[model samples]
Target: MPNWVDGHPAESLSIKDRGLAYGDGLFETIAVRAGRPPLLEYHMARLAEGCQRLGIPLDLQLMRTELLAFSAGLGEGVAKLMITRGEGLRGYAPPPVALPRRILQSSPFPVYPQVNGVEGVQLFPCVTRLAEQPLLAGLKHLNRLEQVLARNEWQGSEFAEGLMRDQSGRVIEGVFSNLFIVHEGALITADLSRCGVAGVMRAALLDSARAQGLKVEVRDIPFEDFLQADEVFLCNSLFGVWPVRSVTGHHWPVGPLTRKLQAIARDLLDI
Candidate 1:
């Protein structure tokens, strides 16, 4: 992977950096294909919103210029941008003047099996539940210890992804992807007003699906109701889409809606 710090080639960050000290940062994982980031706007918009909400100063125009330059020679891969609150003293008090640190990284696209999207994949129900934190909900902040713990609950190919639930026992999302269930001819996804990362792919799909006259509901989906869905799928900026064949004991065949949405995602990603 290639990395850059503050728009320059660098490999290390200070130990006093708030990102390392207190996980005080936000990051975006962008998919780059054919030397372009198709959904750059969505990623940038989300990042900007997080910055504003957290009182972090970010130069979006400069970040955009840097992103384009970084991805220019890269054909197909992933680009990660992390903005931290910068170095600070040994206490929790914020510095009077903040100088945010920008770290950009480029890596080769992850190799996933073709069948993961075509034939679907199995999901493991994680025991670790997401804590309700409305303040931090929907933002891709640096605190991902919950996801890391959930992911560690499983190993190997038996389960392609791990499903996480909120403290209320409502299905929230996958460890590394957003969850969507199709039921009664409508698309249903979890409400991220309380928890979960509002993935860029999920946002794009919501718009596209509604534009096509598809019924889409963004609300709390209980575990029981989720199991009764007609079809299920997971999505992220990198993987595109993966139909959920089964979660725990419940099984769902890849339905037409999943395929339809997958096609839309492919077009949006220009794949």
Candidate 2:
């Protein structure tokens, strides 16, 4: 169960819980190891930036303490830390003095068979297109109806994920993870400024690739490019990385670069 303080499980959210009523909140799905969530700096930076964008006041020290107390002794698993504008007026107007709500919950880590990434996975070309909202784009906020619909559009085992496009018909990303396509031995992924989640793992890969002397292209991806790409992979914080074996009738290989990146990611995550 999730609640606003450490160890106290409240029955219901405060009537003014902005996230439930207005989706006025942000969240992070972090990987916890030894009961401690790693990459705290990156997550905190996102939180601080999210608060600035949403006009919410953020107390980083307080949040740090709460997170530490909440995840204490949980061993290893996934943790979702959320912050919402507490109680507020009935309308969209925020309260003058907002009481922020902090909610934390833990779950068993999603186990991935080592072979899953080593070999490859499948994908479905989702019919749903991500509606671009420049102001709210890439924040990982609570308004996730687009992802919900895209995910619900698929019910096949052949593909473990759905690749989504934007309203402009440009490929954006996978439903939850980031999309990367290899072309001519180069790394390419969607530029997520207009839409899509800015995944933490995807960021790590970008930085790691640059460090390893690989050029990463961030640009608009068209549908036709997938048919010509050498390889594809979907990445997220929890799953780390997964190579795409096929999409629709198009097939791809788990290339050397994909495997090398996966190995680097696995070592980084210590999985």
Q: Which candidate should be chosen as best, given lDDT against the real structure? A: 1
Residue 263, candidate 1: alpha-carbon lDDT:
94
Tens digits of per-residue lDDT, candidate 2, 239-266, equal 8889999878889988988887887778
How would you encode candidate 1's per-residue C-alpha lDDT over 1-271 as one tens digit per residue?
A: 6789998899999988999998899999999988789999999899999999888888889989988877776667998989999988889887888899999888999999898999999999999999999999999999999999999999898899999999989999999999999999999999999999999999999999999999999999998899899999999998888999998688999999999999999999887
Give TM per candidate: 0.98, 0.93
lDDT of each: 0.92, 0.82
In the predicted model 1, the residue pairs found to clash are none
Cα RMSD (Å) per model?
Answer: 0.9, 1.9
Model 2, residue pairs in steric clash: none
Best by TM-score: 1
* Residue 82 alpha-carbon offset, candidate 1, angstroms: 0.8
Model 2 residue 37 distance off true place after TM-score fit, in angstroms = 1.6
